[model samples]
Target: MLEEMVRPDVVVGGYRIEKKLGAGGFGKVFLAWRDGSPCALKFIHLESVGEWGWRELFIMLRHEFPNVVKLLSHFKWPEEKPEYLVLVMEYVPGVTLYQWARDKNPCARELVEKLLPLARALKAIHAKEVKHRDLKGDNVLVREADGAPVLVDFGAGTMPGAPRVTGALAPANLRYRSPEAVAFFLRENRKRGERYDYSVKDELYALGVILYVLVTDVYPFNGPDDELMAEIRAGKPKPPHVRNSRVPPALSNLCLRLLAKAQARVPDAEALCEALEELLEEAKADPHRWEMVLCYGWTADGRTTDDAPELVGHDSQAWLRRWIRQKPKRGRPPAPPVVAPAPREPPAPPVVAPASPEPPAPPTVAPAPAEPPTASTVPPLRTRVRRAAPVLMAVVGLAVVVGLGLAHVLGKFQPPPSTPNPGQSVLTSPVPAEFSPDGPTLWATHVHEVAPPWKPSEADAGAALSKADTPAPVTTVTLSSGTTHMKKKAPGSQAERAKKGNGSTGANVLLAVAAAANMACPGAQIRKEPAPQACPAGAVETMTRQLGLRLGERHGAGMPGEKQGSSEPVPVKAGPISVELAGDWDVGTDAMGRGGRTALPNGTHLTGQLCIGEKRVYGRITQAVTPTGDTFTVCMELIGQFDDERGLEIKSDGGAIKVHPRVEVKTVDRFE
Candidate 1:
């Protein structure tokens, strides 16, 4: 039934076959590419997959579960080969749990961390009322990209009470079977007529076995099937902590509860997931302790590699020495010439004052010769004053008597009286002629006017409007006695006046004009003014605004929201993407092939020039869906080898592309 073999470079159902994955009870699986993405294609013989099996597979595909294998699409070959059904699925790139455990030899913490996702995946499966009857290390995959565990191999699964596809009473893994499952098998084989039903509890027991193996790197119960069954029935398997002392008590207890003999004692998938999440949180909180238990073959004692001196940070002193050696020699920088400071100046000597000599006594003046006063020095001034004193006094007395008489004469002649004060004249002055006899007027005479009665008059009658002389016509009409009157004015008459017989006031003309403006000019203000007087027939003034931008154009030339000088290049939509990919090409299936789309974690879409080296090909990944999964393909015309780098180059026209980090490439490899 599996005889139709597909080789490398074969094209099947629009998928360019790259390599073989593996085979299972269902059929052969192959790694293929379609629509610029990588996918897994599985070929199942319609005869071997009976009605029940197909129905169960369909049910599984219809359900969506996280961390579980997804089915993308399915189709039956119509003409060329009608017996085969093709299923395209997500191509998961990672390693099996068996290989992961063996290669990594994970500690208790790492084992729990990796297995939590698988447990949660089981929870998702169970939530859909489906059971993975066969749960084992080989059915679980650990994604190399992020250590996430993906649950797979749902061929042995079905909804509760559904008939079995293969008609097998039980799975072959006896060491991992629960006690009740083994008891049921023994009863059926020994002719005991007791009926047995499989429950999620049995699957939980299988999960416990997988968890035990992942943590201890050994089966919980091993040896021949008979012996293993006896051990399982006896419920004598050692606690996970006993096998691995490093296992936390909480984790060990949870594992033991899963392996409980009583069906009611086992925890459901939700409880198991919760317990694992708590355990994971505890492990992450003190990562150092977990790291000690879970070294990835980096340290001899399983301790953190960071603690090893050999693996410590680079030596700055060594780097400095190498840098110094590499530098050009300039005579050792001349030793930077040792500069000595100048010597200190000596202190000045202390100053002292000299003794001052006693001041010499002033020499006595010499006596002048005793010569008698001659005729030139004749009479002393004192003798002259005494002789003139009596004559001067008698003259002074005569002059005093004459001054008294003159003073008496001058005193008698006084000035005439001055004019009267101006204050008295002001009190006697009369009011000016311009002064008003009465007080000023009041507010009633201004702004407030009584409305007048209307009276018809000659001016109110239709008068000849002189087009040449009058720009505005009188609109208001005067009416008296509440009577209407009509009178025609002479031809060409312009001036208007009320008829004296009517006792009416002349009509008043009031012109009220309303204007509306609508205009918009980019970068300019719109102002509305009255139209010109000469404008005819409601014509509006046309304005030429100062425009800052051209017609139908924006102010700036750059794309919206993009800065002028930012370093990030604008993403081009629907651009061409050139790819360089190389890896093994084979044809089979079951997640063994490696070449596919460079899928980034978290389902991110990537495009543009992508260069995928062989190391990027981890393994085949499967995401479950219906009909077919994500399709990817590479054309032969675009395939070529890169001489410098070890990869095949493929130039593609991606209608639109987004770059992702899944594909590793040098800076120069990108060509938009």
Candidate 2:
């Protein structure tokens, strides 16, 4: 059904469908041609567009304003099924307000010029007791032909007598909700059934958000949903001038007043329009200051100079003028022609001449004639000295070598013995007093026969350790086998000497020797303490129960008689379904889906981003069309490989399912 609605060259009512324009949570919009004039055809499922929605359309038809998009006609589609409602309206060809600001880099005055008409448009609509509930940057368009702002997308609008459709709170973007509305929602959310009355103040707050984003390129209160809600309820956003100094003080103050929590503090639509007009007049008085680029490097203090080096030989002013006059070409421009150098001519062959020979003349000798003394006959003094210098140096070198050899032969040179530094003591091996060639050595004799194991008195040990060569302090532990083991004390130990009067000097020394032996001998093993015993079963069970309770509390589960949060999945019929992106996709653009069946029937829409790498479609299903042609809101992630036989799939708690593809996807970066 969505495919039939979006197919190009197909006649829908009187207008012919050209292509899809864009998609939102409720429906898909298409650019259609009627009598050679282009118009927008919005196709929304009948069930999703409530009775109040159609009434809002009637209100749009009744009230006409230059800044508001004009509604041409409305009708229900498919006489047999009658599942979708189509609204044909004048198409405003342009980029969104956000995109316009990004490209044109409008100044504070230019922004006021653009937003003034929107404020007046709001005033006109409000005169009839109608409120455009969903006002955002994306909802406002900057007309390409005349640079006029056109307010569009009044699907969430309501009149005084309109029945309630959106539950509890107004239908609006969370980022644009007023602080009072948020505070009311937080306070009343605990009640079983409560509703927050949407008012003019909330609409003005949304306008303030749009202004803040335009000036600073960021949301005033930004974070995760919960944190953002909390901030909207109680937090005070930073003023626009503080975030971006280029913003005018008057504009900044007005934006803050519009976003004030108290409803009385915010100006009505008509007052807001007057305020914008005053600001516009003030901006016109000082053209130079008001016309400076807002988002560029210019600041309130002064222009910010770039630290990067400028391109050599580039004249930016000339280039800008040339660009304005020249029409833009699509895709990458053709690379400059690369010309191969002309083949070099081979070098001309060397000229040759025929050999000419004549008989050699007899050798002739002539008497020398007296001539002036020349450089050839006698060299300069410097040249003569340079020529004789090498021979003289050779003789001197030979004499020096002979004298050194004679001195060495006479024992005049000898190397000095190595000696320790002044503060260092020389180490030497001490022979055991019991060791003798005629008797058994210490290692071969009985263990007790080695001069009673020669123990060092505490005084002697202290004196020996006082030297700089003392090893790190060690602790001796006596084991059950009557063997003592020594280990280095932990670092940062305050005691430098052993405990007084322990009288275990011999054991300590012996333990130190054993420890050194153990380190030096890799194969040696010192007994390690036994492994820790396993915990009792009762203790293990108790820990497990406590851990489960903590985890249950953290996850908001496992407690008896507690109701689950609204976000929990609800049961839905499971079956195979096919879907594809609702419109053309490209990198750095948002992508929406439109096809489904059975579990998610035809006309179901998805919202997501079209990323570059892997060419996969990523997003979630925001609204689902039922098999009976009804629609309901849903949150499920849509993920799958692009162009694969399995197609794209929606990952839900129900199960993974596929959506068959129908059309080839493409994108356009520029247009005529």
Candidate 3:
């Protein structure tokens, strides 16, 4: 049976346990107080006592890292009931990167900026002959006070020359292993005698994987152990841009290089940091090119602030209320007024009432003088006609003069109606001549039939498969919100489709013209009539149904490991991602740079879809230069359809003839 959780007032290692914050592999983490200050106490079960535990304690005690969790003190109980080991460490009052990413997956630039500090932390650990074998998102905490990232959890840590504390046969630790490390582990296991040595490269590789996940919101490789091993043997994985195209080529290339074969990858953590700093400089080089990319940071914490009064006993609710709250002041209520006896003379004065309620005297009445007939009552008819005659003549003459002047001005100023220019007509069309202004379209037919399968690392996957072990939280980040503003395309940008007479563009246009000229409705034809102004909603629905069916036939409905209708709105939080519009622009990215779809400071998700991998896919798209002046943030939702061949091609006569019909684009980001 699991050990009972310690209640408030329960003291361990001179610290009072406040509450169980969370449970980790070797023990439970609790919020505790020591010397009346908040601290974290991790209690390891006696059964978990082993060489690895002792070594982790040793590593933490001997060194300190600015970006790593600090160990304040540790103790073990031998004679105490329910024997246990307790470690007191600094309480990180910040949200885990795993939690932060759930709603606000950082883009490439943002992720790099945040991970740079972690890379330096790794360097520090490496310099001291230590390796944080488990460096996943959960192990990293961003300080709430500042956006600083701190690495935690040393359960799987090891020193360069220390004895192998973990068994070689353990498979769970292989998830983030470098290729060489994996090879060494396998070789040693096969021999049943040799040691599986880990090097700096192995840890660096894991850091690279973390970077990749942060940028793309997915693992670089996935599947069963054998499959992942095969990929490692291949010595190369798909680049980051393959999944997230917005990733700058330089950054993508750097991420790929970091994941290169053991010896080929960057030599050490210090070098990696230097490389990252250079990339950071490059990303922030151009001020005018930058745009705001909202990420997530601290929100709230379970622990109280330093100045908050501590609750002392078992009555948590009542004690907490009294501890932090002040007692209302009870001032001396006003003294009761002293009653004074009325004087005897005053009583006699009340009886001395005045007499003489005599009859009233006759009021003097004066006859009212006759009021003179006031000229204000009305003017005589003759006087009124005389006053109006001159005014009427003056008004008529003014009207006549003004009309003549206007006629003359119109005659002199009128110009002929300008004839429409051919070029103007070509440019005035709503649809572009090309489908994609950037370049050739990656047609659905030509693209891969299925997206590459992805899964958590073997270590993560194995831990997940086991019910006995409580897996560490591993949250995948995404764009937090569904609603996004639609920005107009920049001037001179190509139309949404191909240009007229430009091969595919022209062919599509011809098909549309023919369809307009030939058939007016489904299974019916009209000789000549103004184009239907509004198609019934029912008809549009039918068309959409048909289109979905055809697309389903052409391409599968969903990708592997993905579910239909699985997208849901994530809650927005304050602190970052709230922004203001520039003078010229009506909207801009969040100024604080700390929100995404999941952590919007303040806004409702009106409507939209958050899609992974498709950077350009958006129901609505807003491109704005942020205050950073180097990066352009694209706020988008994946919902509305683009004007493509699939959209233009609608069959009415059972594919007997081609038909190009006008398709009205759907309005996006709308709330009823």
lDDT of each: 0.40, 0.46, 0.42
What lDDT tens digits, residue by residue, belong to model 1 across residues 150-258?
8866655678556644332433344556788677666535454443466888888888877765554445664322344567788755665554455666777878888
TM-score of each: 0.42, 0.49, 0.44
TM-score attained by model 3: 0.44
Off by over 4 Å in 2: 50-52, 188-191, 297-672
**Could you give candidate 3's per-residue lDDT for residues 341-448 as a string of tens digits?**
444332222333368454554554554543433322222222222333333233323533645232332223222234321111011111122212232111101010
Tell me the lDDT of model 2 at 588. 18
Model 2 lDDT, full chain set: 0.46
lDDT of 1 at 295: 21
Model 2, 200-231: lDDT tens digits are 88889999989987776656774323455667
Report the alpha-carbon TM-score of model 2 versus the true structure. 0.49
Global lDDT of model 3: 0.42
Candidate 1 at 250: error in angstroms?
A: 2.3
Worst-scoring 10-residue span by lDDT in model 2: 458-467
